[model samples]
Target: MSNNHGFARIYEQGDQVNYGRSNVANEERHHTRNAEGYRPKDQNKAMNQMLEENIQDDVAERYKHDPTYRATMHGNEPSKGAKIDAEIQREEEELLRRKQEKTDSLPGKKQ
Candidate 1:
């Protein structure tokens, strides 16, 4: 006669447990930090020149046939535009004064 407790045995080889081990697990450390080194002075100057050349080329391409560009490149905007410009400049000056006052009131700054 077999005595069954209706529970499976704890330590059969097929049911053995390996702690902290997984058959399909991947171990990867996914974080890193890296530094970009400085460029030599001559190379830095050459890079700046190349960037300026590209910017000039792009501007020339964009304004090649634009009438507003032709008009403004020579002198002032039309009368209505000039009035709008004056209002914008006034607002800009008011903002600049407020910013200056705020900074002047800070701890080390003098008003």
Candidate 2:
């Protein structure tokens, strides 16, 4: 076998030697962007931002002061009794609303 600089193979018996240099590339671009440890400093600001868009500003402020309501809002503190009470209250309110809507929809109720 002729030992040519380009044509000559490095390994004598095994598969052809494929050589390319690998460097330690910086992984900064592959990192996930997120708020690692960010939390709102102001309680009111945090609450307002987390609240639903349809939630009234005054009602959200009032809810902030209620301990039971707050506990139920966040899952941190469990309130089984409060949850049951809320469910019952919601059903009652929903029934009342449906009744009012049905009454209003009637032709003789109000024009």
Candidate 3:
């Protein structure tokens, strides 16, 4: 229910009966004709700041306790994934080194 008066009111005050109160129920839409599109920003600034602080604190607390969340935030892959990548890169380099040695061992004066 809207508590604002004059142009500030968004909903009209009224009374209704539920199924328990009566057999028939009534419904009405409360859209104020003079309601403005914008509201004062300072009205909820303190409340919003507090909520944001609480959320940041919660995230910080979770970062200390949640391994999965920390890993996800740091990178999209696990530590084991990095190790696997390193192994694959090492294998590739070793293969290239062997190929170079074989090429060096080959005896050819002209192509």
Candidate 4:
């Protein structure tokens, strides 16, 4: 039975869930490149870059002023001994990898 006002019909239809992307067109759009396989110069690039620069400038300004926030992220800076140990381990690992790698030809750069 259908209601004359169509409110019941709308509620009945809404009960059946129409799930995600199953009905969408199976195609991708190349926003950057045109059909001619050439990238058209984006007018928004400069504007976006300037906005990003402004955001970075704001972040740096905040970071410079907010010592507590900086300390919270890093959680108490490591001691000089710990820093030196970490650096030595990293350099040792890098040297070992270079020496072991067969593909990478260091030639005269090898120690």
Best by TM-score: 2
Q: How do the residues 1-111 of candidate 1 rate in per-residue lDDT, one tens digit apiece?
A: 443432132224444222121211211111121111223433333333444555677678746534345446668563666556657767888999999888888997654
- Give the clash count for model 3: 0
lDDT of 4 by residue, 39-82 (tens): 22222232233344556777788566444445445788756665
Give residue 36's lDDT in candidate 1 (0 to 100). Answer: 14
Candidate 4, superposed: residue stretches over 4 Å from native:
1-41, 72-111
Better of 2 and 4 by TM-score: 2
My TM-score estimates for the predictions, one after another, are 0.30, 0.36, 0.32, 0.27
- Reference-based TM-score, model 4: 0.27
Tell me the deviation in Å of residue 72 in model 2.
Answer: 4.2
Clashes by residue pair, model 4:
none
Write candidate 3's Cα lDDT for 1-111 as tens digits. 644432222123542211221111111112222112223332233233334455778889977655456567776765776556657767888999999888887888234
Off by over 4 Å in 3: 1-40, 81-111
Deviation from native of the Cα of residue 22 in model 2, angstroms? 58
Q: Give candidate 1's error at residue 70 in angstroms.
A: 2.6
Model 1 residue 21 distance off true place after TM-score fit, in angstroms:
42
Better of 2 and 4 by lDDT: 2
